[model samples]
Target: MGAPRRATLRFTSIAIGVALAIVASPAAAFCRSTTCTGDCPRDADGCKTTGKQLFWPGVCVGVSLQRDGSVNIPIADVRSVVATSFATWSALDCGGAAATISFSQLADVSCHQTEFNTSAPNANIILFQDTQWHYKGVDNTLAKTTVTFDAKTGEILDADIELNHAYNELTVSDTTVVVDLQSVLTHEIGHFIGLDHSPDPDATMFAGYDDGSTNLRTLEADDIAAACAVYPPTRSGKCEPAPRNGLGDACGASAPTTSGGETSGCAIAAAPSNTANRLLSLLGLGLALRVRRRDRFRS
Candidate 1:
Protein backbone atom coordinates (compact mmCIF):
# COMPACT_ATOMS: atom_id res chain seq x y z
CA MET A 1 0.00 0.00 0.00
CA GLY A 2 1.04 3.64 -0.49
CA ALA A 3 2.39 5.69 2.40
CA PRO A 4 -0.18 7.16 4.74
CA ARG A 5 -1.45 10.60 3.68
CA ARG A 6 -0.22 13.28 5.99
CA ALA A 7 -2.79 15.37 7.77
CA THR A 8 -3.04 19.01 6.81
CA LEU A 9 -1.15 21.17 9.28
CA ARG A 10 -2.68 24.41 10.45
CA PHE A 11 -1.03 27.53 11.86
CA THR A 12 -2.92 29.95 14.08
CA SER A 13 -1.30 33.22 14.99
CA ILE A 14 -2.69 35.76 17.41
CA ALA A 15 -2.53 38.33 14.62
CA ILE A 16 -4.91 36.83 12.06
CA GLY A 17 -8.29 35.19 12.65
CA VAL A 18 -8.62 32.42 10.06
CA ALA A 19 -6.78 29.16 10.63
CA LEU A 20 -4.50 28.66 7.61
CA ALA A 21 -4.28 25.00 6.69
CA ILE A 22 -1.02 24.01 5.02
CA VAL A 23 -2.03 21.46 2.42
CA ALA A 24 0.40 19.07 0.73
CA SER A 25 -0.08 20.66 -2.66
CA PRO A 26 1.37 23.57 -4.60
CA ALA A 27 -2.00 25.35 -4.59
CA ALA A 28 -2.71 26.06 -0.95
CA ALA A 29 -5.58 28.30 0.16
CA PHE A 30 -5.09 31.61 2.00
CA CYS A 31 -7.43 33.86 3.88
CA ARG A 32 -8.69 36.75 1.75
CA SER A 33 -8.98 39.32 4.51
CA THR A 34 -6.31 41.87 5.33
CA THR A 35 -7.03 41.65 9.06
CA CYS A 36 -6.36 38.96 11.70
CA THR A 37 -8.87 36.55 13.25
CA GLY A 38 -9.74 33.98 16.04
CA ASP A 39 -7.36 33.88 19.03
CA CYS A 40 -5.29 35.88 16.60
CA PRO A 41 -5.51 39.46 17.78
CA ARG A 42 -6.06 42.38 15.44
CA ASP A 43 -5.74 46.13 15.29
CA ALA A 44 -8.80 48.43 15.47
CA ASP A 45 -9.81 46.86 12.15
CA GLY A 46 -10.02 43.37 13.70
CA CYS A 47 -7.17 41.71 11.79
CA LYS A 48 -5.29 38.81 13.31
CA THR A 49 -1.78 39.71 14.50
CA THR A 50 0.17 36.52 15.13
CA GLY A 51 2.56 34.78 12.70
CA LYS A 52 1.38 36.61 9.59
CA GLN A 53 1.67 39.86 11.46
CA LEU A 54 5.02 39.04 13.03
CA PHE A 55 7.14 37.61 10.18
CA TRP A 56 5.25 39.30 7.37
CA PRO A 57 4.54 42.63 8.98
CA GLY A 58 4.82 44.26 5.54
CA VAL A 59 6.31 41.75 3.06
CA CYS A 60 6.63 37.99 2.60
CA VAL A 61 9.33 35.73 1.09
CA GLY A 62 9.30 32.78 -1.34
CA VAL A 63 11.54 29.65 -1.38
CA SER A 64 12.21 26.73 -3.79
CA LEU A 65 12.82 23.13 -2.81
CA GLN A 66 15.60 20.86 -4.12
CA ARG A 67 14.21 17.70 -5.72
CA ASP A 68 14.78 14.38 -3.98
CA GLY A 69 16.73 11.63 -5.81
CA SER A 70 18.12 14.03 -8.41
CA VAL A 71 21.72 14.98 -9.07
CA ASN A 72 22.84 17.63 -6.67
CA ILE A 73 22.63 21.11 -8.21
CA PRO A 74 25.90 22.99 -8.38
CA ILE A 75 26.42 25.92 -6.05
CA ALA A 76 26.30 28.24 -9.08
CA ASP A 77 22.76 27.21 -10.00
CA VAL A 78 21.75 27.64 -6.39
CA ARG A 79 23.04 31.19 -6.54
CA SER A 80 21.15 31.71 -9.78
CA VAL A 81 17.98 30.56 -8.05
CA VAL A 82 18.49 33.18 -5.38
CA ALA A 83 19.27 35.95 -7.82
CA THR A 84 16.39 35.28 -10.19
CA SER A 85 13.90 34.93 -7.33
CA PHE A 86 14.95 38.25 -5.82
CA ALA A 87 14.92 40.05 -9.15
CA THR A 88 11.40 38.88 -9.86
CA TRP A 89 10.29 40.45 -6.56
CA SER A 90 12.04 43.79 -7.13
CA ALA A 91 9.69 45.19 -9.78
CA LEU A 92 6.57 45.91 -7.70
CA ASP A 93 5.10 49.21 -6.35
CA CYS A 94 4.79 47.89 -2.81
CA GLY A 95 7.39 48.87 -0.22
CA GLY A 96 10.80 48.93 -1.87
CA ALA A 97 12.50 45.92 -0.26
CA ALA A 98 14.51 42.90 -1.39
CA ALA A 99 13.64 39.21 -1.00
CA THR A 100 16.13 36.50 0.00
CA ILE A 101 16.71 32.78 -0.71
CA SER A 102 18.50 30.65 1.90
CA PHE A 103 20.00 27.18 1.41
CA SER A 104 19.92 24.19 3.77
CA GLN A 105 22.27 21.20 4.02
CA LEU A 106 19.67 18.53 4.81
CA ALA A 107 18.45 16.33 1.95
CA ASP A 108 14.81 15.24 1.70
CA VAL A 109 16.05 11.78 0.83
CA SER A 110 16.37 11.22 4.55
CA CYS A 111 12.79 10.00 4.05
CA HIS A 112 12.57 9.55 7.78
CA GLN A 113 9.22 10.75 9.05
CA THR A 114 9.61 13.22 11.86
CA GLU A 115 7.27 13.06 14.82
CA PHE A 116 5.68 16.25 16.11
CA ASN A 117 7.67 17.59 19.02
CA THR A 118 8.67 20.90 20.55
CA SER A 119 11.43 22.10 18.26
CA ALA A 120 12.19 25.28 16.36
CA PRO A 121 11.40 25.45 12.62
CA ASN A 122 13.97 25.95 9.85
CA ALA A 123 12.83 28.35 7.14
CA ASN A 124 16.02 28.26 5.09
CA ILE A 125 16.09 24.59 4.08
CA ILE A 126 13.93 23.06 1.31
CA LEU A 127 13.32 19.34 0.58
CA PHE A 128 12.21 17.98 -2.83
CA GLN A 129 10.56 14.67 -3.76
CA ASP A 130 8.62 13.28 -6.69
CA THR A 131 5.00 12.66 -5.72
CA GLN A 132 3.83 12.10 -9.31
CA TRP A 133 3.96 8.31 -9.21
CA HIS A 134 1.79 7.94 -6.13
CA TYR A 135 -0.50 10.88 -6.78
CA LYS A 136 -0.98 11.49 -10.48
CA GLY A 137 -1.41 15.27 -10.45
CA VAL A 138 0.78 16.23 -7.49
CA ASP A 139 3.92 18.25 -8.28
CA ASN A 140 5.52 19.94 -5.24
CA THR A 141 4.72 21.05 -1.69
CA LEU A 142 5.96 23.34 1.12
CA ALA A 143 5.44 23.29 4.87
CA LYS A 144 3.44 26.21 6.33
CA THR A 145 5.73 27.31 9.15
CA THR A 146 8.57 29.79 9.41
CA VAL A 147 12.02 29.36 10.92
CA THR A 148 12.90 31.87 13.59
CA PHE A 149 15.88 32.31 15.91
CA ASP A 150 16.31 33.58 19.42
CA ALA A 151 16.25 37.36 19.23
CA LYS A 152 19.26 37.69 21.51
CA THR A 153 21.49 34.85 20.23
CA GLY A 154 20.10 33.81 16.81
CA GLU A 155 19.94 30.09 17.59
CA ILE A 156 17.72 27.73 15.55
CA LEU A 157 15.76 24.76 16.95
CA ASP A 158 13.22 23.48 14.36
CA ALA A 159 11.85 23.91 10.82
CA ASP A 160 9.11 22.62 8.50
CA ILE A 161 8.62 21.65 4.79
CA GLU A 162 5.20 21.10 3.26
CA LEU A 163 4.74 17.36 2.76
CA ASN A 164 4.88 16.08 -0.83
CA HIS A 165 3.32 12.70 -1.74
CA ALA A 166 4.47 12.03 -5.29
CA TYR A 167 8.14 10.99 -5.30
CA ASN A 168 8.73 9.29 -8.69
CA GLU A 169 9.44 10.62 -12.17
CA LEU A 170 10.85 13.96 -10.91
CA THR A 171 14.28 13.39 -12.52
CA VAL A 172 13.40 11.62 -15.75
CA SER A 173 14.78 12.97 -19.04
CA ASP A 174 13.30 12.98 -22.57
CA THR A 175 16.43 12.97 -24.79
CA THR A 176 19.06 11.43 -22.46
CA VAL A 177 19.71 14.97 -21.26
CA VAL A 178 18.75 15.65 -17.65
CA VAL A 179 15.32 17.22 -17.46
CA ASP A 180 15.54 20.96 -16.95
CA LEU A 181 16.70 21.09 -13.33
CA GLN A 182 16.43 24.84 -13.04
CA SER A 183 12.83 24.87 -14.20
CA VAL A 184 11.66 22.34 -11.63
CA LEU A 185 13.67 23.98 -8.87
CA THR A 186 12.25 27.35 -9.79
CA HIS A 187 8.70 26.10 -9.43
CA GLU A 188 9.31 24.46 -6.05
CA ILE A 189 11.24 27.52 -4.91
CA GLY A 190 8.26 29.71 -5.70
CA HIS A 191 6.27 27.82 -3.08
CA PHE A 192 9.11 27.89 -0.56
CA ILE A 193 9.13 31.67 -1.02
CA GLY A 194 5.39 32.04 -0.33
CA LEU A 195 3.64 32.28 -3.75
CA ASP A 196 0.12 30.93 -3.89
CA HIS A 197 -1.43 29.38 -6.96
CA SER A 198 -1.93 32.10 -9.55
CA PRO A 199 -5.21 32.61 -11.34
CA ASP A 200 -3.32 33.97 -14.35
CA PRO A 201 -3.10 31.15 -16.89
CA ASP A 202 0.48 31.88 -17.90
CA ALA A 203 2.11 32.75 -14.58
CA THR A 204 5.15 30.78 -13.35
CA MET A 205 3.40 30.51 -10.02
CA PHE A 206 0.37 29.25 -11.83
CA ALA A 207 -1.13 26.05 -10.35
CA GLY A 208 -0.08 23.81 -13.21
CA TYR A 209 3.16 23.53 -15.19
CA ASP A 210 3.17 23.71 -18.98
CA ASP A 211 6.34 23.05 -21.03
CA GLY A 212 5.44 25.91 -23.35
CA SER A 213 5.74 28.27 -20.39
CA THR A 214 9.05 26.91 -19.08
CA ASN A 215 10.85 30.21 -19.39
CA LEU A 216 8.08 32.04 -17.53
CA ARG A 217 10.88 33.19 -15.28
CA THR A 218 9.72 36.41 -13.64
CA LEU A 219 7.85 37.15 -10.44
CA GLU A 220 4.42 38.75 -10.25
CA ALA A 221 3.61 41.76 -8.07
CA ASP A 222 1.93 39.42 -5.65
CA ASP A 223 5.07 37.33 -5.33
CA ILE A 224 7.21 40.41 -4.72
CA ALA A 225 4.86 41.87 -2.14
CA ALA A 226 4.81 38.59 -0.29
CA ALA A 227 8.59 38.24 -0.09
CA CYS A 228 9.13 41.87 0.84
CA ALA A 229 6.64 41.53 3.65
CA VAL A 230 8.82 38.80 5.10
CA TYR A 231 12.22 40.38 4.52
CA PRO A 232 11.97 44.17 4.04
CA PRO A 233 14.88 46.27 2.85
CA THR A 234 16.74 48.67 5.10
CA ARG A 235 15.55 52.27 5.48
CA SER A 236 18.60 53.71 3.73
CA GLY A 237 17.84 51.68 0.60
CA LYS A 238 14.07 51.68 0.90
CA CYS A 239 12.29 52.18 -2.42
CA GLU A 240 10.04 55.22 -2.63
CA PRO A 241 6.41 54.40 -2.07
CA ALA A 242 4.43 54.21 -5.31
CA PRO A 243 1.40 56.42 -5.97
CA ARG A 244 -2.05 55.00 -5.49
CA ASN A 245 -4.32 55.65 -8.45
CA GLY A 246 -7.61 57.48 -7.69
CA LEU A 247 -6.93 56.88 -3.99
CA GLY A 248 -5.41 60.35 -3.75
CA ASP A 249 -2.66 59.21 -1.42
CA ALA A 250 0.68 57.43 -1.44
CA CYS A 251 0.64 53.64 -1.40
CA GLY A 252 0.93 53.34 2.38
CA ALA A 253 -1.08 56.37 3.50
CA SER A 254 -4.29 56.07 5.44
CA ALA A 255 -7.66 57.35 4.18
CA PRO A 256 -8.74 60.78 5.39
CA THR A 257 -10.58 60.32 8.65
CA THR A 258 -13.81 62.36 8.41
CA SER A 259 -14.24 62.26 12.22
CA GLY A 260 -10.94 64.11 12.72
CA GLY A 261 -9.45 61.53 15.05
CA GLU A 262 -5.70 61.29 15.65
CA THR A 263 -3.94 59.87 12.57
CA SER A 264 -1.43 57.28 13.68
CA GLY A 265 1.48 57.58 11.25
CA CYS A 266 1.81 53.79 11.39
CA ALA A 267 1.09 53.53 7.68
CA ILE A 268 3.91 55.84 6.56
CA ALA A 269 6.56 55.29 9.20
CA ALA A 270 9.23 52.59 8.89
CA ALA A 271 7.73 51.24 12.10
CA PRO A 272 6.38 47.70 12.38
CA SER A 273 2.74 48.16 11.34
CA ASN A 274 3.42 50.18 8.22
CA THR A 275 6.36 47.98 7.40
CA ALA A 276 4.21 44.86 7.56
CA ASN A 277 1.51 46.06 5.19
CA ARG A 278 4.06 47.43 2.76
CA LEU A 279 5.93 44.16 2.71
CA LEU A 280 2.83 42.10 1.91
CA SER A 281 1.95 44.43 -0.94
CA LEU A 282 5.47 44.20 -2.25
CA LEU A 283 5.42 40.40 -2.28
CA GLY A 284 2.08 40.29 -4.08
CA LEU A 285 3.34 42.61 -6.76
CA GLY A 286 6.55 40.63 -7.11
CA LEU A 287 4.70 37.37 -7.79
CA ALA A 288 2.41 39.11 -10.25
CA LEU A 289 5.35 40.53 -12.18
CA ARG A 290 7.16 37.16 -12.34
CA VAL A 291 4.06 35.62 -13.86
CA ARG A 292 3.60 38.41 -16.38
CA ARG A 293 7.26 38.40 -17.37
CA ARG A 294 7.34 34.65 -17.86
CA ASP A 295 4.30 34.93 -20.08
CA ARG A 296 5.96 37.66 -22.11
CA PHE A 297 9.13 35.69 -22.87
CA ARG A 298 7.28 32.41 -23.44
CA SER A 299 5.04 34.01 -26.06
Candidate 2:
Protein backbone atom coordinates (compact mmCIF):
# COMPACT_ATOMS: atom_id res chain seq x y z
CA MET A 1 0.00 0.00 0.00
CA GLY A 2 1.14 3.62 -0.65
CA ALA A 3 2.27 5.74 2.36
CA PRO A 4 -0.86 7.94 2.19
CA ARG A 5 -3.21 4.89 2.18
CA ARG A 6 -1.24 3.29 5.08
CA ALA A 7 -1.54 6.50 7.18
CA THR A 8 -5.28 6.75 6.56
CA LEU A 9 -5.87 3.12 7.63
CA ARG A 10 -3.83 3.68 10.83
CA PHE A 11 -5.83 6.79 11.70
CA THR A 12 -9.18 5.01 11.26
CA SER A 13 -7.98 2.11 13.43
CA ILE A 14 -6.98 4.54 16.23
CA ALA A 15 -10.31 6.35 16.17
CA ILE A 16 -12.29 3.10 16.38
CA GLY A 17 -10.15 1.97 19.33
CA VAL A 18 -10.66 5.24 21.22
CA ALA A 19 -14.42 5.28 20.72
CA LEU A 20 -14.75 1.65 21.86
CA ALA A 21 -12.86 2.31 25.09
CA ILE A 22 -15.02 5.29 25.94
CA VAL A 23 -18.27 3.37 25.50
CA ALA A 24 -17.02 0.25 27.33
CA SER A 25 -15.87 1.96 30.51
CA PRO A 26 -17.71 1.35 33.82
CA ALA A 27 -18.80 4.98 34.09
CA ALA A 28 -20.94 4.42 31.02
CA ALA A 29 -23.11 1.98 32.95
CA PHE A 30 -25.97 3.37 35.04
CA CYS A 31 -25.63 2.51 38.74
CA ARG A 32 -27.82 -0.27 40.09
CA SER A 33 -30.09 -0.10 43.17
CA THR A 34 -29.10 -2.29 46.13
CA THR A 35 -28.95 -1.78 49.88
CA CYS A 36 -25.67 -2.21 51.79
CA THR A 37 -25.84 -4.48 54.85
CA GLY A 38 -23.31 -5.24 57.64
CA ASP A 39 -19.66 -5.50 56.50
CA CYS A 40 -20.40 -5.78 52.81
CA PRO A 41 -17.93 -4.22 50.36
CA ARG A 42 -19.47 -1.49 48.26
CA ASP A 43 -20.60 -2.72 44.85
CA ALA A 44 -21.87 -0.78 41.88
CA ASP A 45 -25.49 -1.68 42.63
CA GLY A 46 -25.42 -1.38 46.46
CA CYS A 47 -23.44 1.85 46.50
CA LYS A 48 -25.83 3.68 44.19
CA THR A 49 -28.97 3.07 46.24
CA THR A 50 -30.23 6.00 48.32
CA GLY A 51 -33.01 6.34 50.90
CA LYS A 52 -36.24 8.09 50.00
CA GLN A 53 -36.01 10.57 52.87
CA LEU A 54 -35.97 14.26 51.90
CA PHE A 55 -34.21 16.89 54.00
CA TRP A 56 -34.82 20.63 53.86
CA PRO A 57 -31.95 22.74 52.48
CA GLY A 58 -30.88 25.44 54.99
CA VAL A 59 -28.19 26.05 57.58
CA CYS A 60 -28.88 24.58 61.03
CA VAL A 61 -30.04 27.79 62.72
CA GLY A 62 -30.37 27.45 66.49
CA VAL A 63 -29.72 25.56 69.71
CA SER A 64 -31.25 26.57 73.06
CA LEU A 65 -32.78 25.22 76.24
CA GLN A 66 -36.45 25.15 77.23
CA ARG A 67 -37.90 26.27 80.61
CA ASP A 68 -37.61 22.64 81.85
CA GLY A 69 -34.34 21.26 83.32
CA SER A 70 -33.85 18.91 80.36
CA VAL A 71 -30.80 19.78 78.19
CA ASN A 72 -31.32 21.08 74.74
CA ILE A 73 -28.87 19.88 72.10
CA PRO A 74 -27.28 22.79 70.18
CA ILE A 75 -28.35 23.37 66.60
CA ALA A 76 -24.66 23.87 65.84
CA ASP A 77 -24.05 20.20 66.56
CA VAL A 78 -27.03 19.44 64.36
CA ARG A 79 -25.43 21.63 61.70
CA SER A 80 -22.18 19.75 62.06
CA VAL A 81 -24.04 16.48 61.74
CA VAL A 82 -25.75 17.63 58.57
CA ALA A 83 -22.48 18.94 57.20
CA THR A 84 -20.61 15.71 57.89
CA SER A 85 -23.43 13.42 56.81
CA PHE A 86 -24.31 15.23 53.61
CA ALA A 87 -20.62 15.38 52.75
CA THR A 88 -21.04 11.96 51.14
CA TRP A 89 -23.90 13.20 48.96
CA SER A 90 -21.95 16.20 47.67
CA ALA A 91 -19.11 14.03 46.40
CA LEU A 92 -21.52 12.14 44.20
CA ASP A 93 -23.14 13.74 41.14
CA CYS A 94 -26.66 13.22 42.48
CA GLY A 95 -28.76 16.36 42.15
CA GLY A 96 -30.36 18.11 45.14
CA ALA A 97 -30.17 21.27 47.25
CA ALA A 98 -27.56 21.08 50.00
CA ALA A 99 -28.85 21.12 53.61
CA THR A 100 -27.35 23.52 56.16
CA ILE A 101 -27.64 24.29 59.89
CA SER A 102 -28.20 27.98 60.46
CA PHE A 103 -27.19 29.61 63.76
CA SER A 104 -28.38 33.00 62.59
CA GLN A 105 -31.71 32.81 64.45
CA LEU A 106 -32.61 31.58 67.93
CA ALA A 107 -35.27 28.90 68.17
CA ASP A 108 -36.91 26.90 70.97
CA VAL A 109 -35.20 23.57 71.73
CA SER A 110 -36.25 20.57 73.88
CA CYS A 111 -35.04 17.04 74.82
CA HIS A 112 -36.61 13.74 75.93
CA GLN A 113 -35.02 10.45 77.05
CA THR A 114 -35.41 7.60 74.60
CA GLU A 115 -33.21 4.86 76.14
CA PHE A 116 -31.02 3.58 79.06
CA ASN A 117 -32.00 5.99 81.80
CA THR A 118 -30.44 5.26 85.19
CA SER A 119 -33.51 6.69 86.93
CA ALA A 120 -35.90 4.21 85.35
CA PRO A 121 -36.48 0.73 86.80
CA ASN A 122 -35.07 -2.24 84.82
CA ALA A 123 -32.93 0.07 82.74
CA ASN A 124 -29.80 -1.60 81.45
CA ILE A 125 -26.86 -0.12 83.33
CA ILE A 126 -23.08 -0.42 83.24
CA LEU A 127 -21.46 0.25 86.60
CA PHE A 128 -17.82 1.29 87.04
CA GLN A 129 -16.54 -0.27 90.23
CA ASP A 130 -13.34 1.77 90.08
CA THR A 131 -13.33 5.54 90.50
CA GLN A 132 -10.62 5.94 87.83
CA TRP A 133 -12.02 8.06 85.00
CA HIS A 134 -10.39 8.81 81.66
CA TYR A 135 -10.09 12.24 80.03
CA LYS A 136 -11.69 14.14 82.88
CA GLY A 137 -14.53 11.57 83.02
CA VAL A 138 -15.78 12.49 79.54
CA ASP A 139 -14.33 9.35 77.92
CA ASN A 140 -15.55 7.13 80.76
CA THR A 141 -18.92 6.47 79.13
CA LEU A 142 -20.26 6.21 75.61
CA ALA A 143 -23.62 7.88 75.07
CA LYS A 144 -25.71 8.00 71.95
CA THR A 145 -28.87 9.97 71.17
CA THR A 146 -31.15 10.82 68.30
CA VAL A 147 -32.77 14.18 67.74
CA THR A 148 -35.54 14.13 65.15
CA PHE A 149 -36.47 17.13 63.04
CA ASP A 150 -39.41 18.43 61.10
CA ALA A 151 -39.33 17.37 57.44
CA LYS A 152 -40.03 20.85 56.12
CA THR A 153 -37.72 22.60 58.55
CA GLY A 154 -34.44 21.23 59.94
CA GLU A 155 -35.51 21.98 63.54
CA ILE A 156 -34.59 19.74 66.45
CA LEU A 157 -37.83 19.40 68.43
CA ASP A 158 -36.70 16.36 70.54
CA ALA A 159 -33.66 14.20 71.44
CA ASP A 160 -33.16 10.70 72.92
CA ILE A 161 -29.84 10.10 74.75
CA GLU A 162 -28.69 6.45 74.90
CA LEU A 163 -25.91 5.87 77.38
CA ASN A 164 -23.66 2.85 77.80
CA HIS A 165 -22.37 3.26 81.36
CA ALA A 166 -20.27 0.14 80.76
CA TYR A 167 -18.10 2.48 78.77
CA ASN A 168 -16.59 3.35 82.13
CA GLU A 169 -15.95 -0.33 82.81
CA LEU A 170 -13.22 -0.46 80.11
CA THR A 171 -9.67 0.37 81.12
CA VAL A 172 -8.23 3.59 79.75
CA SER A 173 -5.40 3.26 77.23
CA ASP A 174 -3.65 5.72 74.89
CA THR A 175 -5.93 4.70 72.01
CA THR A 176 -9.17 4.99 74.01
CA VAL A 177 -9.56 8.77 73.95
CA VAL A 178 -8.85 9.08 70.22
CA VAL A 179 -11.22 6.26 69.27
CA ASP A 180 -14.10 6.88 71.69
CA LEU A 181 -15.23 10.37 70.75
CA GLN A 182 -14.56 10.10 67.01
CA SER A 183 -16.24 6.73 66.46
CA VAL A 184 -19.28 7.31 68.67
CA LEU A 185 -20.11 10.71 67.20
CA THR A 186 -19.69 9.42 63.64
CA HIS A 187 -22.09 6.54 64.38
CA GLU A 188 -24.75 8.51 66.26
CA ILE A 189 -24.66 11.23 63.61
CA GLY A 190 -25.33 8.60 61.00
CA HIS A 191 -28.52 7.70 62.82
CA PHE A 192 -29.38 11.36 63.34
CA ILE A 193 -29.80 11.56 59.60
CA GLY A 194 -31.83 8.97 57.67
CA LEU A 195 -29.10 6.29 57.26
CA ASP A 196 -29.76 2.92 58.88
CA HIS A 197 -27.18 0.26 59.82
CA SER A 198 -24.75 -0.57 57.04
CA PRO A 199 -23.88 -4.27 56.96
CA ASP A 200 -20.24 -3.37 56.32
CA PRO A 201 -18.45 -3.42 59.67
CA ASP A 202 -15.62 -1.31 58.30
CA ALA A 203 -18.00 1.45 57.25
CA THR A 204 -18.45 4.46 59.56
CA MET A 205 -22.19 3.96 59.21
CA PHE A 206 -21.93 0.37 60.40
CA ALA A 207 -24.71 -0.87 62.74
CA GLY A 208 -22.71 -2.42 65.60
CA TYR A 209 -20.33 -0.38 67.76
CA ASP A 210 -16.74 -1.43 68.32
CA ASP A 211 -14.22 -0.43 71.01
CA GLY A 212 -11.45 2.20 70.71
CA SER A 213 -10.39 2.15 67.05
CA THR A 214 -9.74 4.79 64.40
CA ASN A 215 -11.10 2.73 61.50
CA LEU A 216 -14.43 4.55 61.42
CA ARG A 217 -13.10 8.09 61.37
CA THR A 218 -12.42 8.02 57.63
CA LEU A 219 -15.73 8.06 55.77
CA GLU A 220 -16.14 5.78 52.76
CA ALA A 221 -16.11 7.70 49.47
CA ASP A 222 -19.50 6.27 48.55
CA ASP A 223 -21.24 7.47 51.75
CA ILE A 224 -19.92 11.02 51.61
CA ALA A 225 -20.49 11.22 47.86
CA ALA A 226 -24.07 10.04 48.33
CA ALA A 227 -24.76 12.66 51.01
CA CYS A 228 -23.43 15.45 48.81
CA ALA A 229 -25.68 14.32 45.99
CA VAL A 230 -28.72 14.67 48.28
CA TYR A 231 -27.74 18.24 49.09
CA PRO A 232 -25.98 19.64 46.05
CA PRO A 233 -24.25 22.98 46.57
CA THR A 234 -25.11 24.21 43.07
CA ARG A 235 -28.86 24.43 43.67
CA SER A 236 -28.41 25.60 47.25
CA GLY A 237 -26.09 28.50 46.39
CA LYS A 238 -28.36 30.20 43.86
CA CYS A 239 -30.28 33.24 45.12
CA GLU A 240 -32.43 35.71 43.16
CA PRO A 241 -30.54 38.91 42.46
CA ALA A 242 -31.80 41.77 44.61
CA PRO A 243 -34.35 43.92 42.78
CA ARG A 244 -32.95 47.20 41.33
CA ASN A 245 -36.01 49.24 42.41
CA GLY A 246 -34.78 52.28 44.36
CA LEU A 247 -31.37 50.64 44.53
CA GLY A 248 -28.35 52.00 42.64
CA ASP A 249 -27.19 48.47 41.78
CA ALA A 250 -27.45 47.24 38.16
CA CYS A 251 -29.97 44.50 37.43
CA GLY A 252 -28.49 40.98 36.83
CA ALA A 253 -25.02 42.31 37.70
CA SER A 254 -22.72 41.06 40.46
CA ALA A 255 -22.22 43.07 43.62
CA PRO A 256 -20.44 46.33 42.96
CA THR A 257 -17.19 47.16 44.70
CA THR A 258 -15.22 50.41 45.02
CA SER A 259 -11.46 50.00 44.67
CA GLY A 260 -9.26 53.09 44.33
CA GLY A 261 -12.46 55.09 43.78
CA GLU A 262 -13.41 52.88 40.83
CA THR A 263 -16.43 50.50 40.55
CA SER A 264 -15.89 46.87 39.44
CA GLY A 265 -18.12 43.90 38.73
CA CYS A 266 -17.21 40.18 38.63
CA ALA A 267 -18.43 37.68 36.04
CA ILE A 268 -17.70 34.13 34.79
CA ALA A 269 -16.80 33.22 31.20
CA ALA A 270 -16.73 29.91 29.27
CA ALA A 271 -13.44 28.04 29.02
CA PRO A 272 -11.49 28.03 25.71
CA SER A 273 -12.32 25.26 23.12
CA ASN A 274 -9.72 22.51 23.57
CA THR A 275 -12.40 19.81 23.28
CA ALA A 276 -13.64 21.30 20.01
CA ASN A 277 -10.23 20.86 18.41
CA ARG A 278 -10.11 17.22 19.54
CA LEU A 279 -13.56 16.60 18.05
CA LEU A 280 -12.53 18.13 14.72
CA SER A 281 -9.44 15.92 14.61
CA LEU A 282 -11.63 12.86 15.17
CA LEU A 283 -13.94 13.94 12.36
CA GLY A 284 -10.94 14.36 10.02
CA LEU A 285 -10.06 10.71 10.70
CA GLY A 286 -13.55 9.69 9.56
CA LEU A 287 -13.16 11.67 6.35
CA ALA A 288 -9.83 9.98 5.68
CA LEU A 289 -11.49 6.57 6.06
CA ARG A 290 -14.21 7.42 3.52
CA VAL A 291 -11.62 8.68 1.01
CA ARG A 292 -9.57 5.51 1.32
CA ARG A 293 -12.68 3.30 0.82
CA ARG A 294 -13.59 5.25 -2.34
CA ASP A 295 -10.07 4.81 -3.80
CA ARG A 296 -10.17 1.02 -3.11
CA PHE A 297 -13.49 0.71 -5.02
CA ARG A 298 -12.07 2.69 -7.99
CA SER A 299 -9.10 0.30 -8.26
Clashing pairs counted in every model = 88, 29
lDDT of 2: 0.30
Find the 10 residues in a row with the least total lDDT in model 2: 275-284
Q: Give the 10-residue window scoring lowest on summed lDDT in candidate 1.
A: 262-271
RMSD of 2: 24.6
lDDT at residue 196 of model 1 (Cα atoms): 37
User: Model 2: runs farther than 4 Å from truth?
Assistant: 1-57, 61-143, 147-161, 166-174, 177-179, 235-299
Candidate 1 lands at a TM-score of 0.37
Please, what's the RMSD in Å of model 1?
A: 18.8
lDDT for each residue of candidate 1 in 1-299, tens digit (9 for 90 to 100): 11211111211131122212223322222211221212333332122234332222223233233333324444445445545534554434444433532332332223222111222121233443333322212232111222332222222222223223242122223333222334444543444443333342233443333331233355544344444444445422322121111111111133222121110000000112211110011122233233333333431
Residues 151-245, candidate 2, lDDT per residue (tens digit)? 23332222222333332322223354422333444554444333433323234553333343444445654344334433445544322111112
C-alpha lDDT values of all predictions: 0.30, 0.30
lDDT for position 217 in model 1 = 50
Best by TM-score: 1
lDDT of 1 at 92: 48
